[model samples]
Target: MTSPLDSRQILRRQLRQARKNLSNHAQLIAAQTLVARVDHYLSGQQTDKLKKVALYLANDGEISPHLLCEYFWQQSIATYLPVIQGKQLGFARYTADSMWQENSYGIKEPVTADYAPSRDLDLVFLPLVGFDSQGGRLGMGGGFYDRTFANKRPDASPQLIGLAHECQQVKSLPVESWDVPLQAIITPQQSILVS
Candidate 1:
C-alpha cells in the first residue's frame, strides 16, 4: 500500500535515474540543443538588458546550465547560482572566478557573503526532474524553490523558466497547492511558454 507521498517519491526516483542514465554523448548534444532553444526564444527579445537572472548548478542527473551561463556572460546578463540557505534557497553572484563549495546535498554553490533576494531577480532558470506543457514542474521534493519564490505576485519581477531535457517531458504532473508554475519550459526539443 503506497501513499501519495510515497508514489511521488517513487516517480521522482525513476525520473532521476532515467536522466542519470543518459550517455555522455547524449547529454552533451542535449545541452547544446538546449542553449539553441533558449537563444531562439531570446533572439528578438532584449534579454541582454535583464539585470539579474538566477540559475542553478546541475545535480542528481539534472541537465547542465553551463552553456547558458556562457551565453549570459557574452550578453552581459549577471548570472546567479542558488545556494541552500537555512531552510530555503539564496542566490549568490556567479562568475567564472566565483568561489565555490558544496552544500550538504553535495551540490556546488558559489560561496559568498552577499546574495540577491529572489525578488531582485528579473528571471530564474529552474532545473526540473519532470514537467508538462501547462507549466507544471516536478522538483527534487525539497520544496526549496517553492518556498523561496512563494511570495511572487501575479505580476512579479522574476519570471521562472524551467530547463529540462526533452526526455523529461511527461503527459502531466500532479500539481500541489504550493508548486510554483513556470513562465516557460525550455528543452532540447522545444520551448513551451505558458499563456
Candidate 2:
C-alpha cells in the first residue's frame, strides 16, 4: 500500500508534467479564460471589499494570474506578490514600477520593506499542482503557502483561492492534516467553491 506522502508525490509529478506539456497557445487561452471567470466572480460578489489581493508569479507552467493582476490594477486594487521570508513566506506590494529580484528558486519576487501582514489582505490566490473538487490542493511540496496562511481563521479577510489549469484537477486529493484547504479553485473551465 502506498502511504499518503508517496501518493501525493506521484500525483504531483504527473500533474506538473501535464501542465508543462501545454502549448503556448493553449496556455494563453487558458489564462485569458481564467481571468474572465475571476472577473465575473468579483463583479457578482456584490461588494467592493476585495481590493487588496495577493498572488504569485507563475512558475513551472502553473496557471498565470498576470491577467488578473493587470485587471485589478486597472480597477485600482492593490496587488501583492509572495516573498520567501526565511522559513516562511511574506508578501510585498507589486506595482508596474516595482523592482524585482530573483529568489534562489529562480522565481521573481519583490524585495521591498513595504509588505502587508497576511491577515490584512482581502484575498489570496495560490498556484496549485493538483486540486480536487473538495478544495484539496497539492502544492509544489514546499509548504510556503500552507505555513504562511496557517493562522487563517474561518471567515477571514483573505479568502484563499487556488489557480490552476483545467487539466490539473483530480478526482480527489490525498490530503493531510497540515494541508490548508482552499476556499475556491478556479480553472479555465469553471470556478468551484468549496466549503
Q: Judged by TM-score, which candidate is best? A: 2
TM-score (C-alpha) between model 2 and the true structure = 0.96
Clash counts for all predictions: 0, 0
Q: Which stretches of candidate 1 lie over 4 Å from their true place?
A: none
- Tens digits of per-residue lDDT, candidate 1, 44-94, equal 677756888888887877888888889888888889999888878899999
Lowest-sum lDDT 10-residue window in model 2: 41-50
Residue 161 displacement (Å), model 2: 0.3
Stretches > 4 Å off in candidate 2 = none
In candidate 1 the C-alpha lDDT for residue 168 amounts to 82
Poorest 10 consecutive residues by lDDT, candidate 1: 41-50
